[model samples]
Target: MSSQSSTQGAALAPEKRETFSSRKLFILSAIGSAVGLGNIWRFPYVAYENGGGAFLIPYIVAIFCAGIPLLFLDYAIGHRYRGSAPLSYRRANRKTEIIGWWQVLICFVIAIYYAAIIAWAAMYCWYSVTKAWGNDAEGFFYGEFLNTADTVGVSFDFVPNVFFPMLIVWIFTIVIMVAGVNKGIARANAVFMPLLIVMFLILVVQSVFLPGAIDGLNAFFTPNFDALQNPAVWAAAFGHIFFSLSVAFGIMVTYSSYMKRKSDLTGSGYVVALANSSFEILAGIGVFAALGFMAYNANSSVDSVVSGGIGLAFIAFPTIVSAAPFGALIGVLFFGSLVFAGLTSLISILEVIVAAFQDKLGWGRVKATLIVSIPVAVVSLLLFSATTGIYLLDTIDAFVNQFGILACALVMVIVFGSGLGMLPKLAKHLNRHSSIKLGTGWMVLVGGIGPAVLAYMLINEFQAKITEQYSGYPAWFNGVFGWGLCGLLIVVAGLISLIPWSKNSKLEDPEYDQHQQNVQAEAVPETVSKEY
Candidate 1:
């Protein structure tokens, strides 16, 4: 299809589509999405485990090569097609619509469990002030707080502590999502991102001054260059970068769809990338310094106390809060940061799902927001309120990150590049209005190296998951929630894509009205577009 014809839908729907009011707001919102809860807990351990300070090598390489370039690709598609993930892909190419729906489903799964984590963070923020965990932080988290089940399975018994907060989270999210893009999403990021940074900075400084902080810093910065030789290190960098930057998940695509025409697409992406990486590095410094204090308190090494994800956030950090000087302050800052970060990222995830359905059904923003979000909220509440919630969360998170996200990303890149031969077309769209021009190099990195790295990471993940049980969860549980759920998304997304788009949708024979004609006249011609 010609680029002009492919992009005609966007021109027809200018009033219907909401955009970020300014480039500055767009950058802030983008950074808010990228600098998620993982930036604090997961990144520090990922850096320390992969190569300590030496991990910076592949980390930078991954961000510049895979992360930012892919960001621009999302920008191109969304900005050009002017729709949500499904609508954007449908506009880009009819056959690729399934990829977009798959993203929405992934977001759906993530939002369901993700709310629980944010609720945990909110509770922990209060617990920080009270030091509610008492003497045994780990025991309090696993036993007293969660009231976790003994085995890996689903249950109906509810935990009020989890249920209430999860409910509150959903209510707050619904309010924000219903408010629409400019009023809700942009404003929330404007509020949350700065607050997160300030709280985190104070926390980092406080942790650094605490006893044994230098030891943690040393442990973090101390490089084992020999680790660089391991392919796993590079893979770790690529994997973390992918998750960290929120690339290829229909997020950037949806967010960028809101950018004003003639916006500096690539330049803004570079800024978002830089801010995100800088935040992660800052997180590493703060987190490791506290872990060092934890090690010192235990009369042990930093390596012993070092961990990531839920353990680090819930168990390890809480222990640090109990032991470190100004511990209450540390707890508040750290946990509060989690709340802010998680909320922003969760907003982005839900937006992907909400926007997809909104565009597909051509429903009003408020109507779509309620119809989609309420059901998702109900599901999240029911599943995550149970005693078995943690078990299910852990298994589902593992599968989604490994199988769902990684596999889907690889397929999207392949289909867009070699399978459809659309890189040339995409690259042209990016360079036309973008301040930072892209040519063959951007094409090669996104189309070639990007796939190679993702393919390698996916292969490694599949091999490890297939050969061994993930997190020692039961085989049945893994098969049902983990592998089973991932496969289910693909089939469901395919079936949904086959359903005819509502006549109200842009996909249904959009008229080539005067607005579209004017847009085409102003747009750079597609005279140069061709299959790659």
Candidate 2:
């Protein structure tokens, strides 16, 4: 087929795009994408709630069986096709292309709110110097800083402090995006990842020396094995693994697509997985140690100071830092780490949206970066950075994560793993180029085991939603901002997918390389009907 042939998607047309300079750079970037605020704040609480130290067993199991396996699948598909999620999916099976668009849309929503959190981190970094949050950290965070209003309604009231920091966050993200992949994403990760680890390690060491550090460690590591018997504990483990790894967000798919053809897909996936999980455990230790100190001083227990999500980072940690020895320096290291972690993850999320625009519309890096980043900034400042920002952030996060992100992954896994019989083919591709070869067992994990777990998670979330509104907001609020917002994303993705693709895409050209077509041919089952 001619490269000019309109039949094949524009993504297949011969073209050169930036790639990571080396294997190490790619792996670090991938690790950076996976390591985020979630690793630091979210996972520790999850482990505590599930089974404390015992949670590691199921969490590790979920990593190999579901998380790493899916990571490999995403790597295999993207490396073979060498396109962003939308273009790559379209090339794999025309019908499944919408899945890519769905992921990108989910990423768009994530980028807007994710940056807002980063802005909080940036402001908190300065606040650390003066211990500005005072003893009542929660009160200052919710009352003075956020000036939070009723959860049921949206607030347009501008909080200039929030807006300015958020503007910086967006500016930093856009400048990095404009740098392109290697110089931008890889280089940024190369710098930030090490700094993040060092700062976090310092925090952990400082935290462990405190009077009640052992008490914090006990609460974090003491295994409540009986909790393991509950199915919800198992579910939490799997869910944490999935969320922490940054899978199903089109990030791994997009990042892997930039890999050199000779890159070790399986080995790289393993590295990223292990690195992410290891950081999570480290973060749990540091967080709990700090909380333990807080409890000791307050004449309370670890449970009193323990929290997760934004509360843990912005409120609890600040509270702990204020009363601790060398409060200024410790607070700086803690929140500074948040700044680094948040930036790396934010860029990855925004990259998905930027790549979508560039791939489908053939826009230059600068053009695509501005088009997507500006609207996101406006949304962040106006809607999500206000006094009511937390409300919108929580609602959108719940619905988008449950319905938008997980839903896309579930559908993709079902269609490709079972419907089209792509699991083995993708495994073959991974093993062919990767140093660590995969086998039939990997296929079983991805095709059967992973999807079943994901389906259960999705169903469980729905059941929980039915019984009680997520985070206990008003039903009307959940209906609009939660489900209603998610529905709008779907509509937007569908509309965007209808845009005309550039025929000049290298993937469309047979001469650029016949390998992509061969991989797709092998990936699709001949007996499968064309309709789906």
Measured by TM-score, the strongest candidate is 1
TM-score to native of every candidate shown: 0.94, 0.93
Model 1, span 1-532: residue lDDT tens = 6888768966655345788889988999999999998899899999999889999999999998999888888888888788899998988789999999999999999999999999999999999999999999899998989999897788988998899999999999999999999999999999999999999999989989878899999999999899999999999998999889998889999999898766888889899999999999999999998998999999999989899999999999999988887898899999999999999999999999999998898888999999999999999999998899999899889898667998899988898888888888888767766677788999899889989998998899899899998888888999999999999999999999998887777773233244356556664457533221
Candidate 2 residue lDDT tens string, 232-328: 9998999989988988898998999888766788888889999999999999999999989989989999988789988899888888778889877
Poorest stretch of ten by lDDT in candidate 2: 523-532
Clashing pairs in 2: 11-507, 12-506, 12-507, 12-508, 12-509, 13-505, 13-506, 13-507, 13-508, 14-506
State how far residue 203 of model 1 sits from its true place (Å).
Answer: 0.6
lDDT (C-alpha, whole model) for all candidates: 0.89, 0.85
Superposing every Cα of model 1 onto the true structure, what RMSD results?
4.7
Q: How far is candidate 2 from the true structure (C-alpha RMSD, Å)?
A: 5.0
